[model samples]
Target: MDYEISLETLLQHLGEEEPFPYGSVTPPIVQTSLFTARTLRERNTQQGRNEFGYTYTRVDNPTVRLVEQKIAALEGTEDALCFGSGMAAIASAFLTFTESGAHVICVATAYTPTRMLLESLLVRYGVQVTFVSGECIEEFAEAILPNTRLIYLESPSSLYFRLQDLRAVSQLARAHGIITMCDNSWATPIFQNPHALGIDIVLHSASKFLGGHSDLLAGVVAGRKEHLEPVRRTRELLGGVLDPLAGWLLLRGLRTLSLRMERAHKSGLKVAEWLAAQPQAAKVHHPGLPTHPQHALAQAQMRGYSSLFSFETHPIQEEQAYAFADRLRLFRFGCSWGGYESLLLGWAQTESDANGKASWLFRIYVGLENPDDLIRDLQGAIDALTP
Candidate 1:
C-alpha cells in the first residue's frame, strides 16, 4: 500500500501483507537466527544485491524489517534502522558520520546518555563536541568549528522542555556541509516530523512511545537510505540489533499509537493547566501552555503535544518533595513515561546557585487515566505536604 494515506489509516495498513503458509491476519514472527538458501547460485545472487532475502538475523529479519518499514513510513523517510535500545541507535548513528578529530555541535539539554556518549567516550577518540543552548539559532551558528561535522538536537529538551528552531538550525548546518540529527522521543512521529523540518536524520526511543506499553526496549533512526546505510552497518558491527520478539511487541504498540497519543495529549494539557494554577508549582514547562517561552514556535512546528513534561516547585525542602511523591496514589513513582500508568519523579536542587523558586523539579507523565482523577490525586498529594 502507498504511504500517502492518513496516519490512522497508515498505522493499521502499513505492515499488513499476505502472511505466508496459512495467511494469518498478522505477520508471522520469523524468529530464526539464520535462514538456509536453496542453492549456492541463489545465495550468491542474494548477497550481491540490496534485496530483502534474509540470510542472518543480525543483519536483518523479516519481523524486524516490517517494523522498520512502518517507522520509516511514519517518519516520512526512505528507510529506518532499529536497535536493541535507544542508546544503541543513537551511538550507531553518531559513529556512522563522526570520526577522529571531527567536531559535533549538540544541544545543551539533550538526553543524558547522548551527552555522555559525546563527552565521555567519543572525546577519548578525538571527536570534539560543543554543547549549546539550541533555543537560539545563532548559538548553533557560532558554535560551528571548521571541523564541525554534525549538529545534534532534542527539541523540548530533556528536563526543561526547551525547543529549538529546527528549520533554522538545519539550514545553518546544511550550508556548512554538516549533518543534522534529532532525538524525537519526547514528541513521537505522531506530533513532530523532524525530517519535514529539514533535519538530516530523526531518532526515537521506541521504548517510550512506539512500544507504548513499557513491555519492550527498542530504538529507531529514520532518514534517507544513503544516510542510514552507514548507521545500519554500524548496528551490524556493534551487534545491537533488536530481537524479533521486541519487533513484534513494537508492531502491537504502533497499531494503537494514534489513539493512545490523542488521549495522552488532551490529558497532558489539562494537567499542565491545573498545575499552573496551583500554588505549589512555580513554573510549568509544557509547550502547549500559552505561558511557555516557545509556545509560538511549538504551535508552528508540532501538530500536538506529548504527555511528558516537568514543572518547577515553589521553594520546598528535599523531604517535602519526597513526601509529595509518596502521597500520590494513582501516579507511580518511576523513571520512564509514555506507558499506560501515570508516573511522577522528583529532583532536588543541592547547589546554592539553584533558582530559589525551583528548589525541586517534578516531572509528570499523564497516562490513560481520567484527568480529573489525576488532578484530585495530585491535589491530595499537595494537601498532604502541608499537613
Candidate 2:
C-alpha cells in the first residue's frame, strides 16, 4: 500500500497503522513511564538509534510519536515534536537556538504569552528581543541585529488578524543567516503551509484546532529533522513531553480536523461578512473579508481561513464592552477556542495597540454551530450595546 494520499486520507490513517497484539484499529497507548529494553545490549542499541525507541517517557513516548508523525506529515516537514503545552513547545523552540546575549526579532502581534516569554523571561536571561510590526517587512529588516538568531511570527496575527509576508520575510531571514519560526495556530496546517513559503520551523498550539475539543493541551513544532533535534533535546531537558492519553486524544481529534476546518472556513466567512454589514461593527478583521487590509496577501498565502477573527465596534465605553460580552447567550465567554462551541472574548486593546483606550474590540471564534445561530447570537449581543 505504498502510495501517496490526500491530506484528508492521511489524517484518518497516517498514525493508526501500528501493529497491536490484538487487531485493534486504533493504536493502544503504551501508557508507561519506561519501556523494557529486554537486555542491556538491546537498551544501548535502542538508545543509539535515532528512531523513537522509547527509553523514557520524557525522552519519547509511542503515543506522542504517532501524533508527531501525523503533524509532521500534515505540515509537509521531515519531523515534528509534541510538547505538554503550546507555551512549552514555543519556549523549547526559542531556547534551542538562543543563548544568553542572543538577539531575536518577534512580530508585535504574537500571542500575549509569547510576547511575555520574550520580554519577561528571555530578557531576564540576557537574550535581547525586538518587537516589530511584521505587517511591514521593513520593520523586520531594520530590527535585525548581527546576532539575530530567530524571527518569530504569527500570521493573521493573534489579535487583529494581520498577516506578514512569510515568503518575503523568510527570504530576508535567509540572507541574514537567521532562522524563522511562525505560530501557524491561527491558520493551522489545513490553511497555511509556512514551510512551503520557506519558513524554517512551523509551530502550533495543538490545543486549539488540532484538539478540536478543548479537552487536551498540546503543541507541535515541525521542520527538518536536523533543525528539530535540538528542540527535541531541549524538550527532554525541560520535561515537557505530552502524556500518552493527551497524545491519543489529539490523534482522535485529527481524524475529524478536515471536516471541522472546512465547516469553520465557510461559517467564519459568513459570520464575518454579516458582521461587516451591521451598523454596530466599525470594522471586521477577517482576512477572508475583502475589506481587510491584507486580504490579498492572505488570499495568496493561505489556502483557506480559520474560525478565529476579530471585529471592532463603534467606540463604546468599557462597561458597554463588558455588557455586550455578558449578553451573549450562545457564544461562550471563554479564553481559548477552535472547539465545537462558539466563543466570544472582548479586550480593550491588545499589547500592540498603543492607544490603550476603552474601546470595544471583540475576538470571535466561530465553531461547528450553524452560521445563522452564531449570527443571531452576535446580533442579540450587539443589540445590547444600544442605549
Best by lDDT: 2
- Model 1, 59-159: lDDT tens per residue? 99989999999999889899999999899899999999999999999998998999999999999999999999888887888899999999999997888
lDDT of 2 by residue, 194-268 (tens): 999999999999999999999999999899998999999999999988999999999999989988999999999
Candidate 1 C-alpha error for residue 155, in Å:
1.1
Candidate achieving the largest TM-score: 1
TM-score of 2: 0.94
Clashing pairs in 1: none
Cα lDDT, model 1, residue 43: 77
> Distance (Å) between predicted and true CA of 306, model 2?
0.6
Segments in model 2 whose C-alpha atoms lie over 4 Å from true places: 1-3, 17-19, 45-52, 350-357
lDDT of each: 0.88, 0.89
Separately for all candidates shown, the number of backbone clashes (residues 3 or more apart, or on different chains) is 0, 0
